[model samples]
Target: MKNVGVDGSTTLKVYESRGGYVAARKALAMDTNAVVEEVKKANLRGRGGAGFPAGVKWGFLPKDRTTTLLCVNADESEPPTFCNRVLMEHDPHQLIEGTIIAAYATRSQVAYIYMRGEFHEQFHVLQKAIDEAYEAGYLGKKVLGTDYALECYIHRGAGAYVCGEETGLIESLEGKRGQPRIKPPFPAIEGLFRRPTVVNNVETLSCLPHIMERGADWFTGIGPPHSAGPKLFCVSGPVNKPGCYEAAMDITVRELIERDDMGGGMLSGRKVKAVFPGGLSMGVLTVDELDMKMDFEDPRNYSLLGLGTAAAVVVDDATDIRLVLRNVARFYGTESCGQCTQCREGTSWMQRIAQRIESGAGRMEDLDLLLETARNMGMMPGLSICGLSDGATYPIETIVKKFRPELEAAIRSQPAGQVEAVLQAAN
Candidate 1:
């Protein structure tokens, strides 16, 4: 069993011993355009909630454009998702090699690793690795004695979830408030100082080295068709063994939970209540659908759940759905940059309603009002700066739709003892 968090251990020597930099060497030997074509063939999608195809994004850079940039989104602020942290700390060079290959494919001259400010330890680890690469001649001008010239730098973000967004990150990097920019001139066309840029998540880039090292067919064949390659599943909450697990895409929630190799079921033999296959943004799945596989298409087709970043968060029978929704609502509300009227006001309104309901101060009609407000907030595309507006509204809509009985029960019972119990258990 090879350790998955190999990059986190600051064992760059060990990483090289495990065939780490082979992909960069191979990529340098091939034509840049061919590398992009190979990535396209692999069908590698973005792991940063968007699920956009990575190669297609790389191909979007204008051929005539100069001064292209590749920005790695390592700001994993999505609650309960820790896959990127493991990759950065365990296998820094894997990301470095992947970033170089991506830059080569896009003909970018420079790259930046925009990381979360709280990841101080991992940031230092990556910074050390970048220095090692530059010293070893893997980075900087004319790398590996080839005509290609590139450099990689690390930029720390000031702990804003909105900065996880591509355009918001660009603004934050420029020392401004983190607010997402409207698309039309998408990041691919104009990004990072108004030049052509391609923003990819850490996991999306980490897999690139292997994709180029082994071939697009080999990379695509690792996981299920369409949803190709190994995914790092971040399992947390009430599970016996809560941590990250790298496995094929076809593994179901039942297998992941019950199997000893993964989280090994709920702690203390508790009943599974609900599962968020992707993160807070994705719709929740009831216990009845526990057998649903954690793949791109399976959840989409069977459970109506979006596969954003392939992040799996499990909630047990002891957990209260209303309580969880309240916390989730507060996160969105607090993080809303207040750029758009709907998101600015809607997030605050949703949080207040959820809190009232959770605290037993809410009226029966408040449910309908919350749902209507959420629907109204979601009316426009690219509404509040980034998807913060959409992200906040999604869980509210999903919780109301999927757990109406629970909401109704909470409202009807209104017992002080039970409310206190739910509140205590939630914390």
Candidate 2:
């Protein structure tokens, strides 16, 4: 619940002075099962898009498992989602401590922070924090004079968006291309050098310290049932304030954008055309749906995919919807690892269609084709390798679905006499 790095609290000495590693000490003293149970009671969901229960994820590891690895997913490459980056740069020790607690709960001795390579400053900040932790006996050989031991290391990713996926991250950590692996043996049972591994988001791990300190009941009581604990939201686009803000999961999208403490409303007094309520993958929401709650159950009410990373990228009335769609298409298209032909091919096609549509070269049937293509890419009928395709599918599908009228209007309004001008501009 506390923001550590906002006021120059990055140093180990500062972190320790504010009772940073106390939870690790507490976790080390308790039985690992007890720690896991406490986290389960807190109802802390993963902050990394999926929102899976972190405690449940920890429970997936087999009892008495040897050579387990805990990987902290610091690959904050998702567009407009900079909450993790802010946390890492400002309070590196918090993540380090959280990593230690997670490793202890999972009974793992070796932990890796899979950070994005572009986070050059945050990478060094975390590395120095790890070094400080090691020097202070908070990490390495024996954590805080306890028998529990953990060696935390920083594994820099090559800025591949696929590496944000756990298996892909594990593969890249092993010096392979950042493509996802087929699941049957989920990462908890088989991962990271073919041994048991547990991957958790940086924010997910960061929540442990608070959960351990405040107790599960306290943490769970903070938000609505399932959506318990404080959530960090990254709000970008044409807002008066574009930054990471924290609030309970029950907060509505309108409040997040309109509240003075949050986004402080849209800039230039423009009406919102659509908002990617929880980053791009969650799909776009109309201005009328701004009152929708951001909780897991509430998003479905507004026809959203789900709460993905809880990062909102607002698009105001002045911005073109096609441009937004094209941008989303381009990101997924460029990031697809090509492991599955469905995602690899579908994303490219979506990009082409979206670009063509945006450039006034689209036909009336293009919308249906785009929707059909997105649907096919979303679910592979066992052909798709990972969620990348699905991730790519939702935004395009939802944007097209929700803003059909706008797109249609744009197409109809295209000047027939300016075909050459349009073509030249597109080129």
Candidate 3:
């Protein structure tokens, strides 16, 4: 209840009443290195799906560095995930305070928040919060009478999911096509305008203020030892309460779905058929695995599904697996930036096959072809420019592997009624 984004509106008054800027005040009083040390002790990991440690990332920047940049990735284009908008809309100052602390720790003077173009309301709210902070002396030169000077800017992206990637974001910020740059000159070492930059997610940076205020031990005590701190799980589809719930990381999907405080089970008294634990990128889980723990490690341990974005999408018994695959394939095919041959051609191929199969034009051999294309497209370890290729392949691979019987059945059934059922269930 304390950290719920929907509880209080995201405004200067509401934020101040909830002790919003107190962390910024406390941070300004401490040595910058001490703040970095405290964050390191907290073992805070990136919430941007990569799970990189925030403090370690800060430490990677060169000492006595000037002109360093802190870029916040607010492009929450991952399909089933929408928690970042809540944070930006309901609690903008927390992000501001966290940004200032991170900038100070890295000795950066400028920060940019790269938000998704679709988030017009969130952008307006965050822009207003930034204006309020500058007027209130929380941002700009001589903040709270301290020598630290920080300036934050907001940049809206053009609805590209690839922009959620750090290098792609940097490229977009530079007014170029959002293609990912190669690593080894990692973003921490050489990033944004070729200067040492720290690109963090909106949720990742927002937690910094709380970590500083509550101390590392307090944060670590909230969740499981490995995945410390509270996580915001965005549940959608067929659930009685389809919204975001902020709880400890160790909470199980079964508990979340069944509890009145969370998802509260499937809607219309329908039984769950499948669940996508971490958005579509994490593949899918059949009904038997619904009890899997909603942690960073549990999915892999239980179902071999990687925890990609923490977006829980429930699919009830009335759902059709083939239609789900085709819809997801279409999304990836359309969203592919066409930067790489593997992604561009492979996504198109997968989409076509899924469509053909749905239209009853598919041969029994088409299923094998679909699996082959996905496998050869570098779904694992990623051969494309960004993670889009891998993300597309995940659902296809899982559907064919785990739900093969369903696909085969759809292929055998009469095209009119059965295919209609598949398409209808997709909606």
Count of clashes, each model: 7, 0, 1
> What lDDT does each candidate get?
0.83, 0.88, 0.84
State every prediction's TM-score relative to the real structure.
0.93, 0.96, 0.93
Model 1, backbone clash pairs (residues 3+ apart or across chains), number: 7
Candidate 2 global CA lDDT score: 0.88
Off by over 4 Å in 2: 417-427
Q: Name the candidate that leads on lDDT.
A: 2
Pairs that collide in candidate 2 are: none
Candidate number with greatest TM-score: 2
Shift in Å, residue 212, candidate 3: 0.4
lDDT minimum window of 10 residues, candidate 3: 1-10
lDDT of 1: 0.83
Tens digits of per-residue lDDT for model 3, 1-427: 2344445556667778878778888988889889989988888888888678899998998875667998999999888998888788778888888898888888888999999999998888899999998998888998767998888999999988888989999999999988888776888889999999999998888888899888999998888887888888889999999888888888878777768999998899999888888888778888788778877778886544466678888888897787788888998898888888988999998998888787665567878998899888875664766777888888888878888888888778755466556556656
Q: lDDT ranking from best to worst?
A: 2, 3, 1
